[model samples]
Target: MVVLNAVIEAAGLEKTYPARDRGGTPFRAVAGIGLRVERGEAFGFLGPNGAGKSSTMRMLGGVSAPTAGTLRILGLDPAAHGRRVRARLGVVPQDDSLDVHLTVRENLLVYGRYFGLSRKAVRERAGELLEFARLTEKADERVEHLSGGMRRRLTIARALINDPEILLLDEPTTGLDPQARHVLWDRLFRLKQDGVTLILTTHYMDEAEQLCDRLVIMDKGLIADEGSPRELIERHITREVLELRFPPGEHEQVAVKLGRDGLPEPERLEVLPDRLLWYAEDGETALARATAAGVQPITALVRRATLEDVFLRLTGRSLTD
Candidate 1:
């Protein structure tokens, strides 16, 4: 059965921005991107800087119009029904844009009002949201006084003021401590359990793997690949990965030897300044066979393949540069 529960849909969605130079032609930020985010799925955009993630996000949020293509949010055209579509969506931008002058509670109160929420309802929701965000104790405190993580949590609370059906988060945990990041993750997980649709953009592979049910990897305004983390890894890479580090200047010689042996030829091999990675199935078995063949590596570690491995295989480089 082709059950349809998509809340966000895009087809050939494209966006272009004027180049910095006055005489330069416009630049394409998003090119022929097609996506469909289901009602309860946590979808993710995985890419490096300048990968059109933010541009695509803006169009989805109804803040930027596409130069060419179509987008529908909540079954309404984002370009024509922006106000109606925006009312049902929440956005947490990459940069924190909270009103620093207002107290934490006041920030939520004001944002709720923007959605035409009744004052009494806004107040009640503010208290609930503060507890949800774990900022109840800081409700009266100025945003400037809160930690980066606290601010991020508050931003999430503000985004949810209207009980939005879809939430959009752009790098929600950037620059946060481990403890804070986990706290945010826990909150997001709760929302996921409540059946709220989430779309997030992140440079962190672990973040995408942890939270996203499915994701798309974007590179230079194009999608390199799209699938669940496991699907992408299974399709593009092997089950396990082996890392080998050799004292500089010996990798090429070692690589040649390992390639000549009967180990499954790695789907991808990365030569870094300090280490080399071999992507293949059964990393431990591969390592054993390589070692038995006298392919001596300074250090060897076998680990599960990750979304990073899939991305590097598809894009020919690391997501973080």
Candidate 2:
């Protein structure tokens, strides 16, 4: 195994796509971002759609080349040694591309064979991966008959056929139900516990908070902030958030009224279409003050600050936006 402090390193990485029309301006997807992800660390990329997270992942996975700057995977330049670099990396793309005609176990066996493993070795590894993915009971079923979560787990199992040092997952649980998402999260958590370096891009705030040891928030192809979940919240957001939902089209008016010293002013006030987020160290106190000042809302909620708040503050948009 290759041993390195930083399993993945990039300096001023960038990716640009040429415009389709003859006279149109080109679009730069990844705008010169730099990052260092260490071995055995679960690092994440958080961003909305078109924020270049996928583009960055493609470059890091050695599937796409950077338009400019340097990137080193396992201390080897991906541009120069794409094959060797990819051999040690496991990639789970945003969409599952399993061969539906194959049985669940067949999928793994086929992929393991592609890596040139002997028939006996591939069979053994496939058995272990099926259990790890909780698909042992369904091993004989064709992938076309598996549920969404089952197929997702099978995809992950397929990626592990070679026992890669680093696993890259792009939007791992975007379409799953709550229970399915948690089950997948458990599987991912186990991989991290086994000391596999995990690099993932996720739009789910809670998913990022649960899986990422450290993460960068990207917007418009740039890194807005980078830190642990707790650190980012403490740095860019208050300790608590008071969500006040007023009547339709009245939230802005309520925010204006609250800002005129009608209550204990929050550290920051964000006016959204359906609600007003009052950021404060003590949300209960702020809520009390709002009540005393007769700032009645259709509904009110005071909750501890979360990674979603930090993402919203940084990108000025929801995670799915």
Question: TM-scores across all candidates?
Answer: 0.96, 0.95
List candidate 2 segments past 4 Å from native: 1-4, 260-266
lDDT of 2 by residue, 1-321 (tens): 856599999999999999989999999999999999999999999888899999999999999999999999999999899999999999998899999999999999889888888999999999999999999999999999999999899999999999999999999999999999999999999999999999999888889999999999999899999999999999999899999998899877777777734435338888888889999999898888778778998889999998888988887887765
CA lDDT of 146 in candidate 2? 93
Number of the predicted model whose lDDT against the real structure is largest: 2
State the local distance difference test value for candidate 2.
Answer: 0.91
Lowest summed lDDT across 10 adjacent residues in model 1 is found at 260-269
Q: What is the C-alpha RMSD of each candidate to the true structure, in Å?
A: 1.7, 2.3
Show how many residue pairs clash in every candidate, following the order shown: 0, 0
**Pairs with steric clashes in candidate 2:** none
Model 1, 7-61: lDDT tens per residue? 9889999999888899998999998899999998999999998999999999999
